[model samples]
Target: MIRIAGLGLVAVLLAACSGQTETGGTAQAVGAAGPTGTATVPGVPAATVAFEGGDQLSPKDPIVVRASGGTLQAVTVTNPQTGNAVKGALSPDKTTWTSNDRLRYGATYQAVATAVNPAGAASEQRGEVRTIKPSGVATASLFQPSSGDFGVGLVLGLKFDHDITDKATVEKSFKVTSSPAQDGGWYWVGKREVHYRPKEYWKAGSTVKLETTTFGMPIGGGVYGGQDVSATYKVHDSWIAKADGKTHQMKAFHNGQLVKTAPISMGKTVDTPPRGPTPTFNGTHTVLSKVDHTIMDSCSYGVCEGDPGYYKAPENWDVRISNDGEYLHENLKTVGVQGSDNVSNGCLNMNTENAKWFFDNFNAGDVVEVTNSGGPQLSINNGHGDWAISWSAWQAGSALRG
Candidate 1:
């Protein structure tokens, strides 16, 4: 006898005297065929199961399961070897189940789904899916401010191991948060690098953190992500130096309060031979590095040893503000004309006393705004020039921008 369940009812199909055949041999029991190529008892209907992406699946895509002739009862996807189950969400109608997490690269997953018919009959189906293996893997690292204190103007930088073609997919994995929260967004410097900065300078004394769960992330060009990355840093007091080319003076401020004023000699207006113009770039600049004593050379800026404007000499208290060979350093040769004349070569030349003071107070990630410098605004590609862009324009750079 075989029994099947229905809506609060049970139907039994029994064979008459099936213990033996007329020849005294044992009789075989047979049933009807089910949709899954299996045998099912008579009067019971089999539920249909469908798996999205069938066999070869992309690691970046999600898995979906659907049922027909019945409502889905239960569904689970798991990695057989590791016994790790994929997270999924079931539709309210109980007809669909969708994966919530991304699949792993070159990994196999097993899906088991059960569906129940209106008559209360249940049927189950199991299937296997394997994510495509990529040719290469990509990773990322924090390129600036390694878990320490930085000025409010600090821009978080990240460098990717490979050129990421699917930037939106990669960017979506990143998470940035702060204690004293401020609005910020990311800007791609190039295919291999990205930077994050607030609409305005970060609030002083705020704590900022950057993280990305890139493992299993598809980075385009058959490249998958490897490991996750994260970094946390504290924002120090806001240190700003405002330089006025017309007045030949630089005013230093700490946390919105003016701290010091010093006479400085900016770039000369005349174009130096072999080196072209000597005017300093005008706009906001973020400090990249600080050197107590270093040799200053014109060759670094393309003015070679035999060039007319070429010179090599030691300088003290140098704070680098741009990749185009610009610094705030002590220059005793122009001390007499520091307040009256702009006679240096694209640098803010200050007296020894004032230069020492600036070096002691300012740090990397500090800000320097130059005005009336008689030069073009600094390009966003030079140093940490993120602040030079307007807030609206900066937000437009995001791949997910509305």
Candidate 2:
């Protein structure tokens, strides 16, 4: 027997009546009754619907139809409201039919079964079951890598419409697979958000898929999963840029081959208590997004309009690497001093030619490692800073971890 989880259902046996079976106004005598008063007919088909007691069924409960005394011809369960048939599978010997897909809540389904006896007689059985209405439904959706090719450093991010108290059950409902299987796990950032990442960066040219069969799943506090959701994304070639603050240069690598090395001006050391210095953060930062042309304003971060060393100017080829207002963008004024000095606020100042080339080569999910910046390490909560955490520490964030 299959165990039903939190469905509040009581198991009961369903018995078929013994007597003449009629179909289309034609009556045929079934096998005579035995000592137990149950019909035992040879070469006669018998069909029965299996369910727990009561007319109302939980969406988590599976609809099952079994055949006896003959081979089953076909079985179908349809939702009249949506005009969609429930997906299910039949046993190898044609003895049982079991639903394979999740059912909709607060919906009614009609089950029909047809069987044939060895003597070439056919019989049909029909039944109806209604799914119980959920008190509330919880919804979730993927917010990162929105269906496109990205760099290998991508981490799948899922955000819930509401708070989910039952993290383990909700996490277990997800099915994440890759073209070549890679080990990965989900880490809950909070009650409403979760992130998934592989043990290492995704292999180049790998296709990853994430799906959750949350429909009808019991979430905590009498809430069920609203519906199922899924996403598919592909990983392009590995593109990583390493910026050395000490050398004032950034090196670009593609598929482990050094492609381009360009001079860059990092954030200058201008310490202001509370808000801290303007030095660039030192860590492995994932590329979040890119803008072809945008206005770079120092006041947007911390420097004010009238404050010293404050400036707002139109920038080009801006690629945002952190939420802390750090980016790789073109700044013509810093071009002459690019390789020799650190003069900008917090962004990496690059020449127009090199900045445009970097923008054309790298997309989202790419990594940019910064070193010798003399600033605080990036936090995991800052933009795509998933790589900031160590492997063992990252695994410890999982709710399923012991």
Best prediction by TM-score:
2
**Relative to the unseen true structure, what is the Cα RMSD of model 1?**
10.2
lDDT of 1 by residue, 307-356 (tens): 78689999999999999989999999999999888888889999899999
Q: For residues 193-227, write the lDDT of model 2, one tens digit per residue.
A: 88998988899999999898877777788888876
- Measured on C-alpha atoms, candidate 1 has an lDDT of 0.80
What local lDDT score does residue 185 receive in model 2, on the 0 to 100 scale?
85
Worst 10 residues of 1 by lDDT: 14-23
Where in model 2 is the C-alpha error above 4 Å? 1-62, 65-102, 110-127, 179-181, 272-276, 297-311
lDDT assessment of candidate 2: 0.78
Stretch of 10 with least lDDT, candidate 2: 1-10
